[model samples]
Target chain A: MQLKKIKSLIEIMDEKNLTKIDYEDKDLKISLEKSNISELEEDNEDGWIISPTVGTYLDRDKPLKVGQKVKKNEVLFIINSMKVLNNIVAPRDGIIEEILVKENDMLEYNQKVMKLG
Target chain B: MIKKILVANRGEIAVRIIKTCKELNIKTVAIYSKCDKDSYHVFLADEAYCVGESNPSNSYLNADSIIQIATNTGCNAIHPGYGFLSEDYKFAKKVIENNLIFIGPSLDVMEKIYDKQKLKDVLKQINVPLIESYKLKEFIKSKDKNIYPILIKQVNGGGGRGIKIVSSPSELEQTIKELNKTLKEKFDINNYYVEKYIDVYRHIEVQVIADKYGNISILPERDCSIQRNFQKFIEETPSSINNKKLLDEIKQEALKIFQFLKYDNVGTAEFLVDSNFNYYFLEINARIQVEHTITEVVSDIDIVEEQINISDGNKNEKETFITPNYYALECRINAEDPNNNFISSSGKIDILNLPSGRNIRVDSYIYQGYSLKPFYDSLLMKVITYDKIRNRAINKMQSCLDEIIISGIKTNIDFNYEIINGKDFKKGNYKFKKY
Candidate 1:
């Protein structure tokens, strides 16, 4: 059988969402197997507070400083997105190692705003 | 005059718009999601900014972030390129509310065109032939057996989602119940209508450009009949309909509709032509389409530039008649496994070679080492070929496809090559192929 025919058979299997297919005809016999693609990502192990949405970055009323100890769920910063202010809270109890962003800076989603140590 | 534009889109369309802005001496601002930060569109723009996460809702479709970026950058206009917010009436209204020019149709025109039912009603007023449709209650009451294979569709649906076909009377009620569930879950809306489904038909669309003034110019009709899952895979200009009279009629009806509505910017009127050559008006797309490249290749016109000009209130010279100079065809090369049910194939592009030369054009955003993200559409690039004859155009496209190579992931390039060389395509007898 031609390679094209086998390729097409694989397409039929995928379109049918089947993992395997077998075919037998008067003069032709074919079997195909398909392996699904695995989707996985490594977790971010380092301590980083990423912005959740695109907005204007602003400091809280009590400005957070480097080396400051923060409790989990404490409001660390504020992001004014589309006129709605979103509180960027600390994910866990840690000391701030670095302040990556400044006041009134435009921040993008997943951008590193600060680092915890 | 529009000085700067914020392209509220990504991928090839965003790159396509920014290229035109460069030619027209207009600055551009591109917004990218977190994953797209390293993409080509970001580097092509005069200024780029990160918007949100990789997901569309928090990124490309985040109208507020897009508008804020445009305003903060001092851009005079916002070009919602094709997908995200291009036909969004609410976003267009918000752009105007923020004192920025929305580079497409006006808010009122978009409002009517976005609603498929309303657009059909307006077409009916102008005597355009329309497929019979029924409201939910009326369809249930008048479940005529004649129209057995009826199509159920969302009133405000796109991307070919939540559409179902009932082939027999026994399957009608059950199909409706299942379709309603899908619609509610996918679109979060219970509103839907039933229409007579034409089993076999050709998809033909007319491209029109209109300014704020009543001046309208109609281009050649495009045959987008080759499709899979309702998404167009191949498109060509100067449809092989063989009946000049029928083609002319389709173009005339399209002109009349646009002239009546006084539509602004560039838009396309789609139609479904049956075996008898009887054409039924489909809804109009209020923005540029993915296949606009083929039309541009044949007509030698920059549609994006025209869009910007119209948005700037520059009047177009009234030209009622325009003809194509060549035959053009476009094949979309998607980063998907055609041998695996077209599932998106995403990975880093280790090796890449794109075709070039005369009568051939490529519009793409992929490059060497570019990682194909699963969070976006699978369209990798578009390869277009044009010649004075259709046969030559097909031949050129075949060679173009052969010259291309993309490794590290699967692509539909081989499939597209087979399609262009298929007997049905060679004889110009291809219709909407069921995949």
Candidate 2:
């Protein structure tokens, strides 16, 4: 997505008071999210990845650690939800800034799994 | 035995169940949406998990997610305190299929009671006096206009949501369409029924607790006539029913219904007692109710503990009726502006001072700095007061309401304070229609 288009989407999000939005076309796809926890005390500047289901978290082939560099769409972890393994990929290229959860830990939906920078 | 229970609810009821679990040495697991991360229930439970987003469909009503969390957390049973999937027979059935106990009525009892038409038929077989009712389609086809001033209600609607009063045949179809649309948008169910609307009636309900071995216990009746828009504002036990014979009759009728259905665990049977004291069976609430607090205070019984014991098949096999020792009253404090048609208000609580005394108890999940969210119900707390004398109990409730201090939002505290002190309430004949 173009920078101008992304800015416009952010503007739309602000106008509609939406927490997240997804845009896609034939060639490119983008998922944007913004924090609605302004009232909460623990607000952070870095992007946070949240769990999508209540299940056990498992690392891919190798264990992931903090400060590890990651690429966009790379398989970062898998969540075993109801016996089905769901691969959670990186939303964008960034270093593994903070790992909040450990491998084999049970994850609840919307729980903070990792932070990206 | 149930060593661990997943409480599939939130707010005061979750806290209520956790207190009992602590007493019984059963571990508790609480599920919350993201918005409820800082809720009191989360802090009180042995283990807490985020179910989903703030929307109930993705979180509280998400049966699959709830079941997954229970199985993963090693929960031996699930206690749906009230609302959400508490009365959902399908969810109860799924829990049994997954080899976990559902801490409520059996699947067969739930199925029979949930079907409004079938419930009425069963009651008819047992000679229960039910209100004259008809399905929406059947009522529309009938040419008889004698049943005018009928109430159009959603078959699946409870808690005073989908109900309308039509005075004449001319407005019957229009009201039905409106009710159907509202039901469709809310419950996704398009079915409705019409019942002969009694112009003057008192809302009284009986609490019944049964075991697997057909042992049923009927507690004291509660008078829930202090209502607005069909939602109860104040619930009192001993019911202000001066006649002991009438009270016994109501209990007998409730016991008969439970015995016929072979209902297990704790549930409520609601009735509409009219001017002449002719009681008409309304429906059954197949779960623990909000007003169960007052009954517990008066009867000196831990109903939640009883529910746990019954579900575990440890209850004694004998039927008994318990008379209340005190007159107890409960007022639900909601975060709503009574002056503005009860529109809900939400904000961070700056100060919280709950009332406490000799016979006063407050059941709530709010605390200082708690951010009241708009996504949930407006009820903030339940203030209960009890005494040997009914008048003294009302006076105690009036003083208790005055002592409550919740800042940073519009609450119905002042509104409730006025109701308890009003002349009608003092006279012991308060009517909802008059309110």
Candidate 3:
């Protein structure tokens, strides 16, 4: 059973692009943790990066019509966290492919507030 | 009688002050740095404003910005909780000038006690026992006969910043040079003094509450002998000193100092007692101490409330006095590596399991998914335990520590366990220097 658990961790690491996994069974626990160097680098190249700040979603509030061109660093929405209003900017100069959050909605940190293509 | 108060700080202390204000039915306004936008205190306060950038010099320490916030918010008072501008006499003066009560001592009183050397002079005038030594130049002149193994301390410093030990005359010059550089760079004070180093001495402090009506009361002494890097890590009450006479004498002296200072509000007088039972007055903390919970646990007096009331010109209820009833212990759980020079570690808290039971209390602002910031003190939580007996209190504290589960961030929990189990601590035969 221990060998099988270790084999499964290795498979999960490759399948999901995950670096670490903590598992526990009764008193016997194991942590297959990887270094943080690769994880930080992986954030630069992403398919759909979520907004790291909390605020209201602008794109979702007013759905972008088809073929809307969004410039790089153009604020797509604002996430207000009761303290500061964060301007969620586009990751790259791309088209607004989709919107994920609604207006006047509470946003969580690092949640997918919007999607930019 | 403060209708509104502006907290001139951020993070847990701000939240703590806000909670006290809420209990007193006082509206609270919090001023936060740009980086602390999502701080819990900002959400908990009735109103909040952005002061400036994340750096302390620009935000929390900016007296002008804080005064402006308080004036704009229409706050009648401002509470500078402990750090930043808490001890700044100029800031306190500014608050008073703006017709806002600074929830601390008057500017004149603060100025009198802010400098360590000046405070020592005051204690000396009152016949407080102080270690003997001379200035650096005097010691350098009389090196052979005057100078011995002594502690080199900065004249205007606290929190163990510019301090060193010189064992012999040969190393005196170099040590002084280094300490001078560090003192000038850190505290901007080039003055230095030397004192006889008291080895194997227990650090004990008495918490005193003095009102404007000239009534002073001493709330039992706390033994903070367990320390790391000259900073207190664990504090306990009913210090295994069973000598009733000695305890009474120390309490009387502490009260005498408070009376002499004409101090109005809460303060702590620290002392170092050697193996021979000879106690020497170290210094006075003119503000709320970190280990105040130990006293509160035994005394059953809400010190924060008392300070607020006293500042508002309300008299303390004479019947509501503090007398030590049982033993209490407080362990400061810091986010630092015990094995490595106590270096701080910052990360998100993945899991939190605080212990709760009879007479066990945990004061913290941390929750699951909360990130430990690297720009502040490493203290993550303060766990206090109380019992009828000292040994039982220690045992309960150990059990509580064992039950606490903190992941993602490495804490000094393991070191705390080692300290509670160590022979010197178990026997109550420890000193602050051991840390």
Candidate 4:
């Protein structure tokens, strides 16, 4: 019934390698089918900025906003793990495509934090 | 104090380091190859990353990727375990360049020790016995059946690579060509030298430890003589040498090398002992070796913990010469079907039964339902036992091996059984034979 629920179902389908899913409830009935083709290849003439540790991730001072151009060696964010603050640096010069994480979000080891191109 | 550390190698050593880190309250980051996603080391770490693909050149050996992972994961230090980048000069330099702690010898010390010829020259000054290694070209061109029995060894080789024993001048040319071809194809290495092959020899290594403050300690020597094709399967400490005088001499020689080099952290200086009890230095392994477990049990010291503490600048505060209180033996079990000529047995581990109880420790990375990739070393577990005497230790080790059970994949457990329960092993007379 809700779009968020539908999106979550699609994610489960992807994880389970399922092509179709059916659901029926007191007030909702739905059947979704996924096409065989994989999604678009990510364009990152520059690759993604990935999280290096398991911790709550927070942006650097003056919060990094998406669509901003980043230079090589720039401090993008900080991952605080076991009481140590580690800076996540830009591997090379690139423009931020999207920030996949929010401030104070718990990030697993090596999670992609930003897409760069 | 290190809050988090990255383990850059895989297999039991990675798992071993993680256990120590957990004991010291240090967080650990594990890096694995794509094929090793299900590896025990990955599942044991506080956090894990897929560094690269299954091919070692792209993953475990990918120094840059490992460094990036360490920095990204907030690791303040890196433990290069043993093999992958343990003695790498450039990688150690890079780690120091990034201001992260490298838990081994400094690049300067490593370079000095890792240069085999230079190390020999340096140690010769201290009266350390060393076998003469001939120049490659001289060895190739010489008409020396006079030096008939000789070994062609790669300059930078380990784990049984680039080693061929030639008995006659007639076999020299063909063997060198074959070895060079394999070395080039696998390692892109082309350098090798000729050393007089000792037909009958014993492998003895001295375990040495040093702190940054120059305090060095030498532990009891270990007899790593029992091997198949140069790969050690059984290792024992308190070498069967009942003659205290000769054993003491061996330990002193090892200590002299350690002090002379100002070596730091844990390392073992290997030697080949001839029948007359004369010792000759083979090389120095500058990392936490796989057989370190036996030393731990015998000496009652946690080597990995000491490594971490020393990295944090601990001053070998408890430095002292160590004489093992108990005799210890280790059996290396691998996922290989020995019946089929040691072909790798890769697949799901369906059932598992591990040995426990007094005087026994089982170090392994496999679990029930764990599947293995065919692209790595075959060592699956180490069964170590300790007791008041060597005979008791050997018996305990055989029992431990008998108690281990894992189905759905063939293992060399029985091969280990023969060694531990065999007459030659009990007699402590097992020595390497020419192929």
Candidate maximizing TM-score: 2
What shift in Å separates residue B277 of candidate 2 from its native position after superposition?
A: 1.3
User: Looking at every candidate separately, what fraction of the true A–B Cα contacts under 8 Å does it contain?
Assistant: 0.66, 0.72, 0.00, 0.03
Highest DockQ among the candidates is held by which one? 2
Order of candidates by DockQ, top first? 2, 1, 4, 3
Please tell me which model should have the higher DockQ, number 1 or number 4. Answer: 1
Task: Show where candidate 1 strays beyond 4 Å.
Answer: A1-47, A62-74, A91-97, B159-162, B180-190, B199-201
lDDT of 4 by residue, B19-54 (tens): 999998999999888678888999999999877678
Docking class of 1: acceptable
TM-score of each: 0.86, 0.88, 0.76, 0.80
Q: Name the regions of candidate 3 deviating beyond 4 angstroms.
A: A1-117, B133-145, B179-191, B319-321
Specify the poorest-scoring 10-residue window by lDDT in model 4 chain B.
B183-192
| Residue A84 C-alpha lDDT in model 2 | 85
Model 2 Cα lDDT, one tens digit per residue, A35-67: 865322122335677788888899889978899
lDDT of each: 0.86, 0.86, 0.77, 0.81
As a whole number from 0 to 100, the lDDT of residue B256 in candidate 3 is 85
Q: Where is model 2 more than 4 Å wrong at Cα?
A: A1-47, A60-71, A94-104, A115-117, B143-146, B179-190, B317-319
**10 residues in a row with least lDDT, candidate 2 chain B:** B182-191
Better of 1 and 4 by lDDT: 1
Q: What is model 2's DockQ versus the real complex?
A: 0.56
Off by over 4 Å in 4: A1-117, B183-190, B433-435
Ten consecutive residues with minimal summed lDDT in candidate 3 chain B?
Answer: B182-191
